[model samples]
Target: MTEAVASDGNHGSGPLEYGERRLLHLQAARKLLTEGEPIRAVARHLVAAGGTLEPWAVAALREAAAEAVALSAEPEAREFLHTARQGTDSPAVAAELTDLDWWIRPAAAVGALTELARTDGLPSPATAVLVRRLAWHGRIEEASELLAARPDPGIDGAVTDAWLSRLYPGAFGARTGAPALDEVAATHPWLRADADPGAVLQGLALHRGALEPLQMSLLALDGAGTLDTEAGWFADLLAAARRSSSRVAEALLIAARARVELRRGELRTAEESAETALCLLTPASWGVLIGMPLATVLESLTEQGRHAEVPDRLRATLPQAISRTPYGLIYLRARGQHFLATGRSRAALGEFLAAGEIQRSWGADHPGLSPWMLDAARAHLALGEPAAARELAGRQLRGPGGDRPRIRAGALRILAGTVGPGRRPESLREAITLAERSGDRLELARCLAELGRAFTEAGQPEYAYAPLQRAWRIATDSGAGLLLAELAAGGLGGPPVDPAEARGLAQLSDAERRVAELAAQGYKNREIARRLFLTASTVEQHLTRIYRKLGVRRRSALAAIPGLVPAADVPRPGRPRPLCARPGMV
Candidate 1:
């Protein structure tokens, strides 16, 4: 029977009974382990069976557990480690188990690993875990020290070094200006100015073919960037991440995708993806990496004018370690944006400046990274300090990452705001060109709005109409409620309202009347949909019918009739009627 099992495990390919097949698979797993071959398939099978390991299979089980750890099959790794421990007592197996536990429950595993380091000296895997955890907790100096004391000289060591490099660029060594295979820049095309993005993505796909799932995820996290041009590559990676058994990898990929979607002005999708990413892991398990998803969620919410939800989201305290990494800068910027949106310019300026200070101290103050300078400039402008705002904007335009189209466009827009009408149009036009190239609809709309305002200020209302109309369309399509409100506030006009249409409000159903009231108050279709618990398409249909019944050609016309306002809040005679109220105010 033993001989038959061995033969079948190695070479047999015919149909067999279920019991026989199990025996053959176990035999095959043992054979592969003895030969030191890849153990992922074997480990997966054993993990799924949830059976007691025979004493003879103990060594193979240990090997399988280590392989599972490498693959980031967290539950399988734990199961194998637990079962193997029940069969035998080995320090190596114990260390491997501790290392695996670090990924699942870092806070609990920290004490065990610290004890191990004191007594037995840290092993390679344990050392890697400690270094990474230390860095994640914002103990960069200590992480660097520990790494320097015990160099891994292995894959774990390489990954650790790459992570540390991102946290503090020159901590390991001076950059060679050439991409290292293990470095994040090698996988991220945007980080490499000289490489062709398409070629880099293709190379990354080929390179990842032999990597384990966890390694693939780590590389993807390191390479995360705007996906405007490499969206196809991003999609392929996201799909692979979703198919993988590593939950952490899938979460990281989803979080990265959320950021890309946010940049593309897909606010609802961005919020959904970020929330999904957060749900995949516990807050403790996320470590410092929580900043990515958290910041993305906050920014998306702020842009969509969901201010009521923002307070709830911010109620959770972030890990102190996040304050020391690049992720911290992003979080600070997002928080500042929220403050700005809520009219707290002083608080917003403080957050933006603090983020900039941290980045400057880290020598990572590149506008492409966070653009906090431009944010500060906007805050200064809101505080009525044009000179201060212009100075900051000028510095951003002359700074290291100024050439990036997105950053440049933002600076140009703020600079335009500070200048006279003679120079405002030129700067805004350039900003529009840069924004268009960057493929950021939010930025494009902002530049167009500014251009329209500049034209209005110059007494060219005719010229203002085209840009304002274009800006409004972009804002509506992108669900940018804040921008929509701003455009409405700036006097986006419609065709002359026919006095005969004033009675159309009485011809509407309650549902249509409710939708029309919100629309008249400058709510975007998406906002109205959410308020009415309906789809945006449904809201659009209602608006279409309302327009026909009211004999109006534009949304602005809806506000022209006093009857659209609720009777309790209708404006009295001789008071200049407000055309639209900002979101949340209504």
Candidate 2:
């Protein structure tokens, strides 16, 4: 019987006791194989009864792992053999798991296979399965080396797969698309004889926020979706990037930022841009560089009230960032805010407290303390602990190093919201002034909106309207469509039927009518989009037509239409609306 030394991990029947080495060997071999670990490692690590590794142990690992690996059904696990192998012993297994899928996060799987490559023997199907699984998760570097010893990240999957198969017939590893578009961009300059470069400039003119001509051209090319087939040509360009070792990372990062802006209505661009950045940059580098724009997407989704999808990806992006940079508690706290924005108030609070723990872990003078403290206070406040939040806000504002301008305004804004009417109007006004002066448009927008809510709660609807309107304009002009849509639903200051009616049938489609009816009932475009799953812009375009057809210029005109809730009673943030109350409740 093989002597298994004490193992730390549970393989099903508790931690394998060193005394029960035979059972331990069986458990370890089965578990390791099931998880895509190579048989050789399982063999090498196994200890015999006399505490010696043996050939039988190695054979046992191989036989067990092969059996289990063959039985798996997950695309990552089931196709493990075929996904990584160009030629396989089992044709049946090869027939299962090949296709382009958004499900796999390629890099993660690649990192795993890189460790499995140092096996003590010739590559086995088990090892190949491990490698393919790594590539499936976008770990191109490891998969490239293990699979064919080189990866052309710029090319489409078919081209790279074919190239790898030719070079290393038996060991052809990752069968996924090479996703490093920045390197592709650097290698392949955006010049085409048939495509007019000048027309690129013309395309940018329609977008108000876009200013960079080069970026505009890139976005236009992507927007047109005409260049995807040309992905193969990018292979040569990526090879050049490897040879020159150029830093196109910044460009790729910007591409992601620009994609977030340009793709406005799609979540895939966020992943696309980040994947591109990940291919070129280390985890920490891309995490720090990509965090804000990613945060913006997270924030936008949260404001849109699409909480279901916001937390996971955004939260996953944080650990790398917090670990690598001395990002003073602010970014970490901002991360928590990202959670809250997604409607996970409790999680947001916990994240803030965690940041404070990190601050203590890194020591107080670390520049991140300010951000951590501010975030913690904000989180506590958001969780409805007004007194605790108020205390933290006061301390954060007056404490050592003092408050950063934007943070101070944020703290003031929270204080105003929780401090009740008589004591808060001044704080709300002060917060608005501070936010305006700092030019933190993100916080500024929130403060302005919250100010409106503070007044609304205080029985001052007229005062509330100005700030709400100001926030609404800021949201709209800045392409903060989520915030703009939220404000537009606030049915304030009028009776149903006081607003205008439709005149011409020409402007409204049946879909647009349904959309407008829902929109008029105080649903933001996000809610409408969710109910419809069409892009928010599609919903917006229909509404644009609705205004024209109904002869109602803005949401205000539509709100006055009969049947939806009265305008004044509509809930905005801080107002909370009335719980399950009829739409007309004050």
Candidate 3:
């Protein structure tokens, strides 16, 4: 018979030694098992032994497996379940094992689980997996119904419900109340102590629109000033994810880091991190959550001027349910930017407007989340509809996100384009100041470029030189090839011109000269018409006459001539003087 250890200190103890106390605890656990106590009563003691299963009873092993599953200790759970299975073919043990396996390798278990749900119905342990699967497949209503059928949905079910609530706030009839991160950690001591804390942290960060708590949590976890730097925090989180037993949790944490990197303008790192996260799970497994990483990758690629690679990246099969989430808005905006870069202004405008409609419907029309109005305004400007552009920019300026420096700067930049040359510098200077405050280098470059163009259009060559040079350096450093191209097309960054190109300046009328300068600077007839407030046909006629006078046939030949210099610098009598040639001359 196994020795029954004393619970009371009846063994005349002065003070028990460490070995004696451990032996006593082990014996007491065995005594409880022999006395027909429930396996759960002694399961913790047995698990604490932590070795080969030969010394443990089958019942104790099964209970240990269940406890490990609850704690999300996948490897320990698998080992205990395997040992228990060899001794007995208990269906409850098998179900627990299946659920454990389903968390990491859903593809292998989804078919069996689906059929089980259809027929005899899932055991409580398996229900959460099926619900998640249904939601992943875009059967959200069905998932909600199945979850509602279960009265006590357990810890896993509650976590899934919380994620769904955040991902699609109003998709179901009402919001499901989820426990806060602290509450969850307090209630489930096992999760707090043994399982990865990142799972809880990711759930809290999802769709919540705040990062202070996340940053604070990381600091607390790593001690003061240890993970305070962005790189350090990101690495710490990534290390935690790697050590986690759940692949889903790891992917979610990595994706979250990718988004943060994207916002910080670390494009290469964001793209790599997002790609790594996507590779951890299959597309169907990601469901609507795939949008987080996929959007980051798409936006990074698009911004880098690698437009040719975008179509293939976009060919992934996404769940239809993604369209209802904030992730979808990100993807839509990124695609619109791509369209604009590729000269599909009308298509880009349609995408931007569609995103705006969705935002309005969802009542999430905050410009900080997605400045679709500014995007639409940019599309309008590209389409040569400055009035429409101005209207949209003005509306954004007067709306919710207008107070944000970055959003305000974007609106001002667009507004400057639609206004007269006399007012353009003021709007653009304010835009430049706001862009600098926002710390977005790309935005600053855009504003500076516009200011330089305003100075150029006003025939203030001396004033244009400084802003254009500053913009050139910023654009080159930011890898903004599109902005660089725009600056180049505006005749801001080019070699010094030969004086001989000025010979035809005296032969053209003022209107014809304006058209000729714009043409030489690479503006199409429609674009020139928009800038000069003329019809396209009139601009085309002026271009034809200018080309004849300059002895040029194609627009390329026009570009070959040196860009417009100040009329005062031209050795011709018919040219007009610069508007802002010197200080106090405006």
Candidate 4:
């Protein structure tokens, strides 16, 4: 008889602590995850544990899969994720327990999805829609095949149509070229969670096809003002989803952002909301995974010029990211951005290349591609490859008809400065237009400040003041550090300091510069480890040494390293003076 024991958040007890069954095997596999154990640890361990695995053993396998993903061990993820997904609902069969999630309580909606998908005894519509939801999660392949496998098209249609309307809202309505819609009966419906019946009724207009589309739209809304009104609609749709034959509704329920309302005015609320969301959705993450949010938060920090904060955040979260997350692009992009911000164009280019590889794997027009292209262009420009940057930018912008404001503004600013004479006016005007349309007040402000610099460089300083002043106003109100830095550096803030008259450089080697540049760009020791192909500990050591040599105490100071930049008529060998702040105050 095996002892039943607990594994984090998994309530009740299980037969044997996974470790106790074959403690030696489990310990050895864990070491292999770090030390390159047997190269066949999973296989070797499975053999040792009697060809059958326990739940904790399964949990351990999942954990190892997670580590492999963190290490960019793509080969391992394909094998591991497939195995874990297979074990999701099996109560009697257990193999490896590295994932831990298997032994623990499965997240409500996700667990429902797993059970319903594998267990056919449930209602037809329930399992059918459940499969479709799984498809959308990008976990399984297309749901169409699963739907085809069912004998009842009517039930499948109802389930699929219901989910579709909820997912895309306004998109569900019929247009001249649209497919003919079969009506879903109002009485057999499951959607009843609406706080206000009128709005949803209006949105759906009693059209069954509109339900999933609407639900999808509501789920994607970002602003508080809109999300506030849409919350009840989401709840209703989610409620309907949960009650439907497919347990997939629980997936959406776990994904619902209605809780985001609780922290309308509080930043802490987002943190709490994210944590709760993570816990709520636990093991099964319908395609709406954690990587996106982690990337989103990191990008927000980049906008704030706090790029150095990325490592600590990643240290806390990366281990938890799903193996197949498309967020791989984002991780590399942020790493590149950190390097670019710190003036290491060449090293940044490597990261951009790595990110581009991942993004391209998804497709060129993938939404994530826009930002990655923009970052890649910046990297090229920093490396003094203006022609290459321009070519890439033109291709990307043309495909989209235009880049998003942030990318457009950045690309144009670079093009305006780098590709001069005849193209200057056209690029500057485009940059200005982007600055205006971004809606991020600070983003617009940075554009304006950069525009002013463009004018001054183009022998139009007299035309620069108005835009600079406008930029200044936006920055003061937004309190964005990067924009503030731009205003100060452009000499529109206060008096400018001479770079040569500034402090001296800390003696650094080529590798340290590479390390510092990436560090400044927000690469954690682990990310840096992967980039440099060195051990995580080695990256830390390099960072420590770089800090000592640079005379600055933290990774944040790498950007301001005076020695890194050639003297701009400033003195050397001292600490950087605090930058002049207020545009006028400076």
Candidate 5:
């Protein structure tokens, strides 16, 4: 019998020690797998020892090894399958093999698993895996057929049914005799430790009540990957919240809208929505949820080149993120974006990879939720690994998870970045079309800018004008000032910075300009606020607006522009300028 690991959430007897020990063993196992040890032998050894270990430890090994199969090479995948199949003639081992096959050849696994199920009745979990794989492969008919064969699939089987219902609505509901809907009700009768979004959606479809939609809306937003394709779903949720008169639901919907708008590149709209949400949901409440629409607010600010203006409240919320979950992954991803925006790609890469590892460990390595693959690919390109970047993007594109229109758009965008100029325009055009159709305004603007650049580089200035003009209009209307400036930097058709120097300077209010100048003169926020006779929060707000108008990220960027701050007033290194330095002010 396996030794049960005592988990009291304490030092040596709990989950902490168990996790540490598992990590040590995983490291050893990885090393062994790296060496010439046969997988069957390794499996035999681990299984024998598993009798003396906690169930979690054994399960950890299984999950990690299974992950290696998808993330590793063909030889490694085969090795993992070999180990899983070792010394097992039972239906359990057969089911394990079927799941392992999904990592390699999903389509092939479908037929084989179906045959196995027909020959000998399979367990519910195994059946669920088969159905999920089939749905992923777009084999809805076959999956439905298999589901129909099992009269009462139990709770585990309902998971498969729920996925099928959501993924293929045409085959469910009024069209398919409500089979999927029936299964949904069977599995989720109450709240449990695990949240199933599909089950929640089914409740909405059945007109269960406001509470289900409210709860489901939170989970949906929390798990919303890259694509804003769920705009329709959000719309439905908002309508339901309004009907139910749920203030909390309405606030969450506003927050979710802000997130979608941010993805679309509508900076001004996203900020407005996020502000509304923040007002409805207090900052304290935001901290508890770890998603107060703050991320979108910060992202919008950063993308508009107002990085320095990102709310202190937003930055303070990072520590509240719960790792090893979708919520944490998204937070980590946003933080990574902040790093990337500020030109810290190395740190960005770490966060992105951490998010990716968590997603992979959960077996939810889809592009819709995390899109860590695209982020990491971009980092690799920045790190000057074109081959690696292209390879990684290509892998994601070929996977079923990449089938979502938004994921495909993102993957193509990365591919465009990795490819040569000759191939960029075509890839970018496709990406732009997808982004536009998917309603991701920012991605569309970026792709348009890229395509215009590609055309200009190809010595077709006339061909570039149309795309550039459209991009400029979108960026201007969307408050995507950073994108507008980037177009100018790329030598597209945006207003020349040199010519607009005086106008840029005039755009800031008198107080705003003063704060900008003081900031540019090496005074910190406290010093500047003191000198201006304004609260620090007010000063920060002024700075954000000033950054937006002037299209600058930091005081340095503001100082770099001529006619904004006097050259002589520019802060130099070494000694304190003391422009606003009071006696006690350091």
Candidate 6:
């Protein structure tokens, strides 16, 4: 009898031991195969075992050799498949060989398998391979029908079902379309034996030349709060897909690019990417697909207080969210934000509550993504309910994602607003630190503005000057007009123009303007000299020129001008560095 090895992995029986010489020949064949020996040479060594080896063992070697040839070219795969079919009538062996070719040369494998099935009715194994090939090409209906037509009570059937569940979770009675991974793992025990959904989808995309499933999987991973924003793997995969020149692949990649850019705080670039993706995808066929990009656009616009520019169709799509999906939560949250920006606190709170309920039910309310807790808190705070706002923010702070810098910054911002004077500064300062670390320009600017306001409210305008100066710089660079207005309202700064006496202020040179701004901030001549990295005599000379231009001799008179701060001052070594030069905002 020939020696048999387990082809079904750990689910099956152990390997059957062979005679010493038979084992040596099998080992030699494997060694030759690994060393890049020609498939024909490796096949000869394995075939020389003849009756000494098990039939299954020979089938295994033949399948491995077929896979090796499939890697070189499609013609070689066809040649190997034809040779194998001529020698064996076993459906199991044919199915195994077909699967190997399915990854590398799927069209040829499918054609040969279809012909074989037509000539002689396919057994469960061969039928399974055919089913996967159909599904891989997006023939979901046909694959479903084929799988339903063939039912086996053996391990082959179980394995087939497991694979279908992994590739298309919807096909196996599991909830699909952004179902949480934990939910899928709990419901579909068969999938527990396979790799993660993202990995499985990636493997299918690479092997079967089916990029759509992987595209959807990327979106699903993002929605499920499982995507690793820091990983370059997804980017590389998208680049590979783009190289294939598949429009759907490029569209999916464009949408994913918008998301990545948004996470990195490149809001304008993100919006552009989103808009490009929206143009590529069909409206009717990709209505659900447009939700994420629309939300990204809304976020960018709302942050910049350009709410009037949001399109009518995008606003109309918000309330039609699919329940229990991540897209639903995102849409609702975005809608609530729109309401908040438009000063409709009650309406915003209603949308937030609905989103919160969905997130709570799913147990996937991560702050890094949905952040409904912060959304609700901001709404309540706007509604003059400090206690409620504090409670909501506190819950988020205690959650798993609280340690994430963005989440921490948001929670701290809310706390800063709610707390008493003594504790407020500490919270706001910590929030600013976290925001800076996260590299979110807008968030850091907001925190700094808030901190400056808090200081001014506490009768400490001198301490408020630095943060407001920094905040003004960031907000101006990022085109955060609303934040600039807020800073202006708090007696800090505005759009780089003096609220009073605009023309004389315009007369000052850039260096004199720097001296005037420092003087206005109450820096003494020597202190201004130190900050500006100039000698006291040069500082005095600049100040004299600034005073002549402003027609004000006293130091306190220069403190009142806006839009005149120059970059001549370097921050002291212990303080956070000044903002880097970024391209002008769109």
Comparison by lDDT, 2 against 4, better one: 4
Candidate 3 error regions (>4 Å): 1-73, 81-99, 106-109, 112-133, 151-162, 173-231, 493-586
Clash number by candidate, in order: 0, 20, 0, 64, 5, 5
In order, the Cα lDDT scores of the candidates are 0.68, 0.47, 0.65, 0.49, 0.59, 0.61
**Model 2, residue 185: what's the lDDT?**
36
Q: Tens-digit lDDT track for model 2 on 51-78?
A: 2233344344334334433332123232
Residue pairs with colliding backbones in model 5 are 225-368, 225-369, 226-368, 264-441, 264-442
**Candidate 6 — worst ten consecutive residues by lDDT sum?**
569-578
TM-scores for candidates 1 onward, in order? 0.69, 0.40, 0.63, 0.47, 0.49, 0.56
Provide the RMSD of all predictions against the true structure, rounded to 1 decimal.
Answer: 11.4, 21.3, 16.5, 20.8, 21.2, 13.5
Q: Give the poorly placed runs of model 4, Cα more than 4 Å off.
A: 1-112, 132-138, 141-215, 218-287, 316-339, 342-364, 367-369, 401-410, 421-425, 486-586
Candidate 2 residue runs with Cα over 4 Å from true position: 1-245, 248-297, 311-324, 327-331, 364-370, 400-403, 477-586
Query: For residues 338-417, could you state the per-residue lDDT of candidate 3 as single tens digits?
Result: 89988999999999999899878766564654689999999999999999999999999998778778889999999999
lDDT of 5 by residue, 166-249 (tens): 333334322233345444555554333354554454345322123334444455644444324255765675666544312445
Q: What is the lDDT of residue 245 in candidate 4?
A: 27
Tell me the tens digit of each residue's lDDT in model 1 across 1-586.
3355545546645466657667666766667556766666555444433434476566666767666654545577688877666655555666667766665555566676555444346566567656666665556666666666675435455555655666554445422332364364544333443544434443443111222223323333333334432567666766655554445556666777777788778887788888778777666656677787888889987887777678777887777767776667778888899999999999999999998888777776646547888999999999999999999999998987788788889999999999887679999999999888887789999999999888888987767766776886777667776776676567653321223553577789899999999999889999999989999999999999999999899999887765575423111112121232322110
Which candidate gets the maximum lDDT versus the true structure? 1
Worst ten-residue run, lDDT, model 3?
568-577
Order of quality (TM-score): 1, 3, 6, 5, 4, 2
Q: How does residue 126 of candidate 5 score in lDDT?
A: 72
lDDT tens digits, residue span 134-177, model 4:
54454343344455455454544554545533332222222222
Q: lDDT tens digits, residues 1-586, model 6?
A: 1222223222332353345444655666676666777656555445544422345445545564555442433344444444555556766556655665554334345565555444346776567566655654445566566655665423434544555554443335322233444444464332453546567444443322344355446665654335553557666666664444223455566776677666555666676777666565443323344566667767766656666665453545322324434555556677778788788998999988887776666545545557878888999999999999999999889986788888889999998889875568899989989887776678888898888778778887667777877888876665555566566666654533432456687788888877887788778999989998999999988887877777777877666555544422211112121232322100
Query: Between which residue pairs do clashes occur in model 6?
Result: 2-53, 2-54, 3-54, 496-563, 520-559
Which stretch of 10 consecutive residues in model 1 shows the poorest summed lDDT?
A: 569-578
